[model samples]
Target: MENLERMEGQCLCGKVTVTAGRRDAVEACHCGMCRQWGGGPYLAVHCDSDVQFVGLENITVYNSSDWAERGFCSECGTHLFYKLKGAEEYAIPAGLFQSGSDFSMTSQIFIDRKPGYYSFANITPEMTEGEVFARYTP
Candidate 1:
């Protein structure tokens, strides 16, 4: 994580700023809830607990699931992050970052739920919905 450089980002309106000090490879989530939330699979970067938010007044968090919540800019409605309710981990949209972040698509979750209309060329690991839940079970 020390090698992963810090990155800076902001929403479309510049009312919300995201700064992350640690992050792992990017990931794509193909769950129906993700599609419904963003009109497509969520291409996200895993920042774990290292993301910092500036201008939080413009950020609104919605509890999308029992254990998860999603964040967006209240002023511009730019999708921010999907976070675990019990932890500080965050999955923020990869596009939101303005800096050239050092991340690669290394995994895709809910592979079985991915629609047939499109596909990613990355030869990354894939996990089905059940596999995802099993790994994250509490």
Candidate 2:
């Protein structure tokens, strides 16, 4: 069960603000698109349906590719979320939060396609390209 706690966050310029409830599990993503967009491993906190937004006027949405759309602060260029096309929800960036939560990454996605420069020895839930594609396919 998800705790009924409010999580507050804003972009670097404070131009965009997000208020969401406690999420289930935060996870790290190692896909190529994530690395290019985030400049590092993408840490994502998944919420089922308890997300709210403020200062949305400052947010910029870009279709990074055909499959995913990236959200960021237009004024500050702070990456916020990635929404998969045809998926029902968005994946919020874990780093944009204020950071006092006890959440820890419980799994990793797109592990097999991860960059060769990095590695994780600990075993956790992971997905290969085929698995991810099939799960998200409409």
Highest TM-score: give the candidate number. 1
Misplaced by over 4 Å in model 2 are: 86-88
What candidate 1 gets wrong by more than 4 Å, as runs, is 22-24
Global lDDT of each candidate:
0.89, 0.79
For candidate 1, the TM-score is: 0.93
TM, every model: 0.93, 0.89
lDDT of 1 by residue, 1-138 (tens): 345677888999999999997455689999999999999999998885878899999999999989899999999999999998989888889988765455678899999999999999999999999999999988
Q: Best by lDDT, which number?
A: 1
Count the clashes in each prediction.
0, 0
* Candidate 2 lDDT over residue span 80-133, tens digit each: 788877765768888777663677678988888788887766577988878888
Overall local distance difference test of candidate 1: 0.89
